[model samples]
Target chain A: MEWQNELTRLVKTSYPIVQAPMLGVTTPAMVAAISNAGGLGSLPVGGLSPDQTRSLILQTKALTTKPFAVNLFAHQNSPVNTAQADQMLQFLKKLCAQHQINYPKPDLNSIIFHSYEEQIDILLEENIPVVSFTFGILNKEVIHAFKEKGTVLIGTATYLAEATLLEQNGIDCITAQGMEAGGHRGTFLDSKTLPLIGSFSLIPLVAENCQVPVLAAGGIYNGKTIKAAFTLGAKGVQLGSAFISSNESLAIESYKKSIHDAAETDSVLTKTFSGRWARGIQNKFMMEVENSGLAIPDYPIQNALTTPLRVLAQKQNNKDFTTLWAGQSASKAESKPAGEIFQKLIKETESLP
Target chain B: MEWQNELTRLVKTSYPIVQAPMLGVTTPAMVAAISNAGGLGSLPVGGLSPDQTRSLILQTKALTTKPFAVNLFAHQNSPVNTAQADQMLQFLKKLCAQHQINYPKPDLNSIIFHSYEEQIDILLEENIPVVSFTFGILNKEVIHAFKEKGTVLIGTATYLAEATLLEQNGIDCITAQGMEAGGHRGTFLDSKTLPLIGSFSLIPLVAENCQVPVLAAGGIYNGKTIKAAFTLGAKGVQLGSAFISSNESLAIESYKKSIHDAAETDSVLTKTFSGRWARGIQNKFMMEVENSGLAIPDYPIQNALTTPLRVLAQKQNNKDFTTLWAGQSASKAESKPAGEIFQKLIKETESLP
Candidate 1:
């Protein structure tokens, strides 16, 4: 199977597949394993402090000298809305009681976030080869600074407008995030519009409209999906949910097991978990919190508030309370070494008729 | 390009493309024109009286001796809620006043609809060779009756479960309607869930999981999209918006003009026009109605109530008031003979790398 020249040249990988930088799930070892296996492996440093980000980058570098990317959340912290947060907290408390677990009030005032500026400084110091961003776009100065150092920039877009904007901003690559993709939607423009586009629709539009190299992301898995992405004019493919259940992914065993056993219909998009709409396996927390009609805080705040429940659920192995972040194609995912999954993906892509 | 065996055999068409039976648009000439071009042409007979249905079927038969499919809306009528309908009517009245047009009260009690059973009876009596349906599924008895007459059955599904249900009931083919498609969602299940799956994601899932042959729909217009669909495991493709601007289509000049002038980001899903979620180019009606937050009556009722405004809008060449139902790729649609469009699509699909 022939591959797009731009992606191969830009990422300098043997294959066009990318192991997605899943927050809280992908580790340095997993990233290195994939990078060493001929695919670009990404480190998601969205919630990490500057020191931790530096340490992980060094750790990944130490593990593999191959080129890899570091991903960051480019979003500005949303203003804290106490009333809305409290109502959602009340709803969560009820669910916790039902599950026989204690719900602690989140430290709203002490809520801290990783500023992209600090992360960029660390990336610049380390001379990171590739940097990818989600949630929002980075400012012009930061993007310019990274480019001056010969760092490749990749941005995520859920719509054609975002892809066009990213292209206009001189980004090196764009990942078209279809609605079928799990985790937070990479919609940088109007989040209120809600992501209604599928990868099939978004990929072609972005490819046709944008001049930059395009990476198809979302529900893509296996050889057929890779072929479909290329057919849609995407240069490469980035996958998150497919790796969530991988042996190398950092998700809890129960979370991985849930993804393995999930049906295609088991996933749904809900903002109850993180205030930003995300696709994941439907759990009691999602259904009940969503049905409650209670106002929820914005991202980072809602995400931070739910951290306790997620941690407790993991410890107890109560799958009902855990957020099994997965995509519509989660059922198709298999738990295996990241290297094996990467090799299989490449083999399957090459074997397509 | 080689096509799937089951689809080519089932439709008896040289090419693996289906011209979607768009409501109140596709004409007998268009249907016959497509059928004569070696592609399946479908007649949208939904909401018509039994006599009208028979007449249209006869009209199409006279135009094309080749096999074509008769399509119906197999949905149960939503119960009338007078309170909600009244509130929406008032909202419409105010909008009409703002537009300097008089609004008349609809005959609420007399709002009647054509049942699918009667439509099926007409189709069977006419000995239609092939039949397709959207909005909902047909009952076992109706399906059995149609099959007894050697009629081929096609059903629409937005989700995998819907496709499975259709397959279990002995559907001959399934059209996977991704979220990017224009017009009313073919979703028969909870419309409240909102169709979130895209064609790229939905087609593969449905194709991989369901037993019946799959036809990819939504956002497909050009040869590249057709190639992408096939690569994702679709046996054929069903196109609606692509033909909306065709010279053979029955859409008004202004409506067709709007589609021609559309951009990649011009369309949005709104419930204002039909009280059912539908994707179309945004206009004053959509913006105002949505912003009004006024309760709208169930479909058919709302569809009937808004007819006069659409008629006036077309007469005035004001595209804002008309329902320009189009898929996300409507901007790529061309105004040409249906035969020419079908031939081009076939050529493009054949020429794909």
Candidate 2:
């Protein structure tokens, strides 16, 4: 049951589950141990600068030599204009005055992170095991480049039509995401469609119709859903929320503990956190931000403007100001060390009674 | 491809699509042509007498000796006490008067046309080729009795858990219904937990998980969907809405025309018309029933009480008083001779572009 079909041959994992590479939560060590324990591990690089991405990859490599994946946000790059940035800075300055924090000058918006080209170059330079992209399609040139470099390519899609689009665009595998998954929104594939498919509905539809293997993600924290995904014909499962507090993760300790203390219904999707849509436990700043109805900045700008506040809130152990992004299954998150957590996941898979 | 499925073996037809047995619309001739064309034809028994069920079986056989399925409502008998029936009738009396129909007494509640047990007995006695139960489950004994007599026992479930429930009991096949299907709302598996697994979500999930044969039913009116269903691993597909307006069907011409003018968003699920959950085109009667705060009786009784109004509405071609049960794919419906429709459906599976 553990070693069935092409997925086992590709990943060399015994179970049909992969600990998903969450941008800020999943660590290189976590990915390595999970892969070593018979499941694929992933490291996503959306929140880091290009040099930072290079450093994280180097650091993750030092921790483990096992095969692992790295995820990239393929959304286009653009920064907020100085005028909008200044207005946003003034608004934040007022909030800082109210909160009694010295308003820092906003040079944070200048931080341009790894473009896919830059990231792809680093991945090829380091010979990364697998490369996955989300939030948009990879064009022909990129696909050809990655194929030449012997990368296993995967695409994230929230609907069958989008999964079909990804397949048409030459993705080796498709991640059929549900509405329940946390982190940055993956609605880029079908920004125009009215109906969004949930995980329970999307996985089977994509799996049944697509010729390639489908990886199920979103709200899958345990072995029960792992089994359910396999039963739904998913060749593999990608987990997002289960690795938060693992020893390999770099998120603030307070952030990790908040995940452990979360409730099933605590998570809500709001652009307030990042300007782009994301799911996190409802926090004070988020609630206030949500109701402010101020024309917020788009993806990268919104993410940048909120960074100072999030960092300050984190430094102060203030869950209210921090983003605290979590999947719907956050409450079930465990605080175990990375290696043991993977082993426990496998153990739980074995112990389904 | 027409020869590539269980539906071909069951109905001995070239097309796997079945014209759903709409309670007030389907007729013996419609079922006969579909079965003759090598697709399952369903004769609805929810509105029939026990004698009608027995005679319809013989009538269908006289028209065509081909195999066919009979659909029945299997709600757990909610005992109808005299007082409850009186209260419901008195409540409906004012509404019936508003419709300009004769206010009949409450004899309709006591008149159970066909108990599930008695209907099961009739099918066994007649040795019908197939039987599908909806609205809820029948006892295991009924399933065994039908199967023992060589009847294929199909159960309809709105969610996977209920499908699992049917599988745990003794069902030969299961229908994964989405919110898009028409007729009486058989969503009683659990009031709160309707998975509403639309065809896009349900077909592959059911096909992958259930060991029994899986049938894709709901909102499917085209060959592309039938072909898609087979690709998703469904052994066969059962269509209910496509045949509603076949040349052989008993639906009033006005009803058939109404179906043609429908848009994709035209049909919605409402507890109108029959006082049971059903998906249909919005009508004056439906709007009235919805506006009235009076509670409705469960199946059969509510269905029976409204029978007079519906019949009178049909006689007068009055749209307001009749329940037009239609699935969401009503826009795609084409009125043809049943055999021609079946031929096109089978041809679609055989020849894909």
Candidate 3:
């Protein structure tokens, strides 16, 4: 089987498999391990500050000379609505009290949200070879700057319109994120009604229309699924949940165990944790918030408000309060080293016709 | 490629493809055409009267000597609530008046709700060789009767639990109906929150756990998707939207045209038409009902109220009022004869590795 395709050549990797860049779960060591093992590894800086992003990139660079990608969150910030924020704070307080947990008072004024624009200088300064973004597309100036630096730009799209828009705006590649994908959706066109097109339908449609190569993401955890993506016209495949249980992943033990014990139907799309919709295991916090019928504040704000609860949950090893982010096929995830997982994907794919 | 798998052998078809039995779209001519072309054609009797079902079976048998299957609606009938029905009637009348269409007066008492149990005697009398059902599993007596007649039984499942239930209840085969599937969801375990697992994730999970042969359904149109389904642990593939544009389909010209122009993101799941959630093109009727926020009466009652509107819409060639049921990949459907579609599928699969 021929493995040298446009995607592999563009990423400069031995294979087309990509380790998805998941915030909070991805570590510099995991990214370096995958890149060193001949597949493209992505380091996520979506929630990190400029200094933290630079340090992680440097750490990954020191660990491996192989090319890896850096990821950014390109969502536009919504203006803070004080009334809604206060209501959410009250709701969280009452809920935390019920769970016999301490509620940390969140200062909305003190929360500093980093925009993708602020991270552009760091990427240029670090001389990053590849950059991928989710939640939305980057502005023309940012895209131009990346292209001027000869950086490969990969945009995440959950709809056909978004995919075409990415191509028209000079994006080198598009990652077709399906509904089964873990983490926040990359839908920018119509966020109110999230387009939940699956990979089985999304890949062929995007690949057929877009001039650039399309990488299939969401629910892809093994070689058979990777092969299936290729057969459905995807140039490559990106996997996130498959690495959730990996030894190098920063995910806590309880979070990893929850994924291991989950079934295909266990995960659901919810906006209770963050204003942006994301797939995760159904836990008590999510259910309680959803059943309360309170409107969640927009992204950054809600994410900031829930930080203390999640951190405490992690410290106490309570899986209920933390976001158990995973894809629909999280049950297939195995606890192993990142390099071994990458090698097993290659072996499984090669063994098939 | 060897097409002689357990699925093919059980259905006695040359290829491992099944033409989905879509109510109101599948006709005797279409069923015979697909069966004659070496694929299993399924005739839908879910909405037909016993005599009509018998007549359709005889007509299909006369057209083709090859084996085919008969589909039934195994959903339990919900009791009709008069107040709810009256409210639905008033809503439909207002909608019809706004569209300048005459609203046919529907008599609730005159509406005959047929059960799967009622259709069993018809199937037995007609000596149907193969049987398939959607929405829920059958009782033990029904299964025993089919087994005694040597009829091949196939059950539709939208979740892993449903698939396992079907297997445990003596179902010979299971069709893993993904979220991308057209028409009504076959979910029975917990219908309140529909399971939206994609085929990429659903197929492997169900196949890995169930002892029966699994068939992948939803978003499957061309040879590449068919090949992808097989790679994802599906023994065979069942296609619904692909045959929507066939010459023998009973769908109105306007409905067919809607599917021909639909994109992967055009279709959405809504329960406005039948109380049971179904995927269809976004149109005026679906939008109006959904936006109205009226509580739709359950299956038979809602279906009855909408029947007159759908029929009149078809007569007047109004695409907005009729149900344009289609899968996510309706855009990939080609207008052709049913037999030609089947032949093209075989040729395309054989040409691929």
DockQ of each: 0.56, 0.05, 0.75
The DockQ-derived docking category for candidate 1 is medium
Can you list the residue pairs that collide in candidate 2? B12-B38, B13-B38, B20-B240, B185-B277
Over B1-353, each residue of candidate 2 has an lDDT whose tens digit, in order, gives 43546645654555556667776777889889888876788888864668888988889889988788898878765655556456667766787777667755547536764567777778887878788878788887887777678777788876566778888887878877755577665566553223344454455556656888777776565555665555555677777678877888767777888888865445666665665678777787776666766677666667677776678778877666787778766655678887887887777656754
- Judged by whole-model lDDT over C-alpha atoms, candidate 2 comes out at 0.71
Which candidate ranks first by TM-score, i.e. highest? 3
Model 3 C-alpha RMSD vs. true structure (Å) is 1.2
Whole-model lDDT values for every prediction: 0.85, 0.71, 0.90
DockQ of structure 1: 0.56
Candidate 3 wrong stretches, greater than 4 Å: none
A189 in model 1: Cα distance from truth in Å?
Answer: 1.8
True contacts kept of each: 0.59, 0.00, 0.77
lDDT string for model 2 (A1-353, tens) is 35466776665556667787776567777877787777777877865667878887887788777777788888876666667666666777777678876656558545664567667777888988678878787778888988898788888887666788889887888888765677766767434323334454466567778999999886566655665566556888887677777777767877887788764345666787666777777777776765666776777777777778877877787777777888766656777777787777667666754
lDDT by residue for model 1 over B1-353, one digit each (tens)? 77647898988888788999987679999899999988899999888889999998999999998889999989888878888877777788889899887666677787678888888878888888889999899988999998889999999998877888899899999999988888888878763466567786788889888877899998899999999898888999999998998888878888888888876567788878877788888889989887987777778778877877877776777777888898878878888998998889888878987
Query: Which is better, 2 or 3, measured by lDDT?
Result: 3
The reply for model 1, stretches above 4 Å from the true place, is A82-98, B190-192
**TM-score evaluated only on chain B, model 1:** 0.96
